[model samples]
Structure formats: C-alpha cells, structure tokens
Target: MFKVLMIEDDALIGDMVKMFLKEEGFIVTRKTNGADGIEALSRFNPDLILLDWVLPDMDGLSVCREIRRVSQVPIMIVSMKNKVAERVDALVAGADDFMSKPFSMHELIARANALIRRSKLSIGTDADFNAPTLSVSAIAAAPVSAMKPAASVEVPAEEKIRLDVNTRSMRVHGKHVDTTYSEFEIMKCFVNHPGRVYSREDLLQTVRGIDSFVTERAIDVHIANLRKKIEDNPKEPKWIRTVWGVGYKFIPM
Candidate 1:
C-alpha cells in the first residue's frame, strides 16, 4: 500500500481527506502545520504528499521547496488559491501537481494513483520496460520502401504527437519528456486535435474525464509546466499557443 502525508491546517478538511484516503487503501499520516509536515517527512517517508497553501507555522511553498531539496517524492498542492499565478508559483517551487479546493474525490484519487504509477516507473519498477534502444547500425541502415497502409480509408494520424499510450510514455522531437499521467492526458488531447481551440472548462472536462470543478486558472499552471518541458522556448511556445480571449490550442507542425 502507498503511504501519503497530508499537511492541512483545517482539522475538518484533514479528517475528511484522511478518511477517504484510508478507504482507498492508503496509509495516511496527517500533519496540521508546515513545520511538522517537514519534520514528518523523515519519519513517514511517504510515497506522496498532499499539501495546503496556508499553514500554521510556515507557508506550504517554503516547505515544498525545502523537501524538494532532499527528495524527488511527488508533491501535490491542494489549496484554495485558484489564481493562475499562485498555481504557477506552486509548480515552480517543485510541486508535481496542483488542485484547487472543492475538487472531486474521484479526480483526486485518479491524480494520486497517477503519481504512484509515475513514481514506480521512475524507480524502474514497471513490468513493461521496453524503452527503445538506439544503435549506430540501426541509424546508418538504409530505409526500405514504405509499407502499405493498414486501412484503405487512409485516416491520417495526428501530427506532432509521438506518444505510446499503451506504455504511458511520450517523446517530443526525439527527446523523452517526463510527465505525470494528468499532464500526459491533457497534452494528448491537444495533440489529437491540433488547431482546435479549447477553453479551460472544455479542457478540464475532456482531459480530466470529469466535470469542471477546478478553476480555469489551474489549466494555465499545467500548460506552463508542459511548455517548460516540451518547448525549446517556453516564453514563445510552438506547439501549445494561447488564443487571447478564446482559450488555448495546439499548433501542429
């Protein structure tokens, strides 16, 4: 079973979350202050952490930064701050995912499970580890004639996407991009429908496979991190572009 540490000041909220997590089969240890949360890190050694922005002793962002200085364990910020800038700040401080208050229990569970899966993969514990290997001979070999199309209808594959959904892995321009499952799903949606504008509400519904409980601003945070990893220049993104008042879209190459 995966162990989770929750750093939340509100007793009611912390108890509710702990109950749900226990029911989901996770061993949860709760802390009500940021300082205690950081100290619990060494004792709990949890697989993941669920943190709140406001704490009694210290701000959660400071705790996140300090913990990240020592470990790569996934951290998810569960806060009431719904601003895009706040979410981006949390991500920049080393959080792996961000969720606003009043989030769906189902979505929360899905995100937690995704973090666990990603942690396992990063630790090389996956059963299916068929990452492609490149060789000099294979690169130098001459190309053969193109194979016949599988279907006569000739449905063109979406452009600028090189992800293997079966393996939960993705590559952009020959470089592997590491991302959590939620991030991967969001990116895949854009890649599958290039040049199609999607509002934050639309994206939350489609990508997260749920209702739009999360704020539109949260989408910006995920997009910012996505661009930092996938784009050569995040300040001027190539694949994902903002559409002023409408929303955002993927510009296929």
Candidate 2:
C-alpha cells in the first residue's frame, strides 16, 4: 500500500480525506500542523503528501520548501485560497500539485493517485505498480509510459533543449535551468511533440490535475517563467511561441 502524509488542520476535512483514501487502499497519516507533518516525514517516508494552506504552526508553502530540501516526494496542496497567484506560489514553493477546498473527494483521490504514479515514473521504480482506473476528465490517470523523454523523438542537431527524465531536470544551451515540477511537466509535453499547439486548458490539464481550480491564465504565468529561463530574449521568445487566440507551442531551435 502507498503511504500518504496529509498535513491539514481542519478536523472535518482531514477525517473526511483520510476515510476516503483509506477506502482506496492508501495508508494515510494525518497531521494537524506543519511542524508535526515535517517531523513525521523521516519516520513515515510517505510516497505523497497532501497539505493544507492554513496550518496551525506554519504555512503550507514553508512546509513545502522544507520538504523539498530533504525529499522529492510528490506534494499536493489543499487550500481554500484559489487565486491564480496563490496557486502559482504553491507551485513555486516546490509543490507538485494543488487542490482547493470544497473540491469533490473523488477528484482529490484521483489527483493523489496520479501524483504518486508520476513520482514513481520519475524515479523509474514503477515497473510493478498497478494504479487504479479513474473516471476523471482532465486528471484521469495517465498510461504507464506517459512520461517518456523526448530523446526518442527526432529533433534537429542544433536543438538546444535537453530533458533528463531520470533527474526530472531540463537544460538549455548546455546550462542547467531550474524548473519547478509544473514547468517541467509543461516542457515535457511540449518537447515530446514539437509544434503541437496546446491550449491554456490543455496545458492546465497537463500541469494540474482533473478540473483544477487554477485559472487558465495561470498557464500564461508558467509559460512566461519558462521563456525567461530558456529564451535568450524573453521579450522576443524563440522557443515557446504564442498562437494568439489559440495557445502556446514549442519551436525547437
């Protein structure tokens, strides 16, 4: 069974989530504050974490950063604050995904399972794992080999972008570019199929899970952040280009 550490202060929410996840065969440990959550990290060694924005001790963002310093376990922040900037802040703080309160318990479980699957894929340790079938629109569980690197795709010899799936890292022009999990997922989808137009909703589905609370415009923010890192001049981006009314696509150099 996969272990999950959920750091949420609300007794009702925490109990509800625990009950549902338990039914799904997950071994869930619930903590009411960020400090206890962090303390349990070493002991529990959970495969995934579900965090709350308003913890009694510290905020979810701080707990997220603290966990990132020690482990790469996938984290999904559950919060009542659903603003685009707030969502982006959670992602920037090293969260792998985010979920807003008042969300359906069904969607939360699906997203949680998806994160665990993705984490196993990134580490190449999912040869024998079997994920449950989920009936979600945007956050449906992906195929086993859905995250294959773009190395298999034929690109030009002058291509400057490289992705290391094992390390979950991206490099541009022979230099390493720091990418959050969200940025990496977007780039992974882009490079695997160069020039394929992905609408904001499409990218949102790619980064966040089924029926995510993040606004489509937040995709614009993630794209801008990527442009600043990989593009020589973000003002006139060369790699990722906007399709105006449509969305964005990757243009290999």
The per-residue C-alpha lDDT of model 1 at residue 26 equals 97
> Using alpha carbons, what is the TM-score of model 2?
0.71
Q: What is the lDDT of residue 4 in candidate 2?
A: 97
Query: How many residue pairs in model 1 have overlapping backbones?
Result: 0
Which run of 10 residues does model 1 get worst, by summed lDDT? 146-155
Q: Write the per-residue lDDT of candidate 1 for residues 1-253, one digit (tens) a residue.
A: 9999999999999999999999999999999998899899989999899999999889999999888666667788999898878876886676777889988887889888877776666444663544322211221232323221121221124323465544446676656666654566677566555567988878766434222234566577778878998888999998899999988987755
Cα miss at 172, model 2 (Å)?
3.5
Which candidate number maximizes lDDT?
A: 2
Which candidate wins on TM-score? 2
Give the TM-scores of the predictions, in the order they appear.
0.56, 0.71
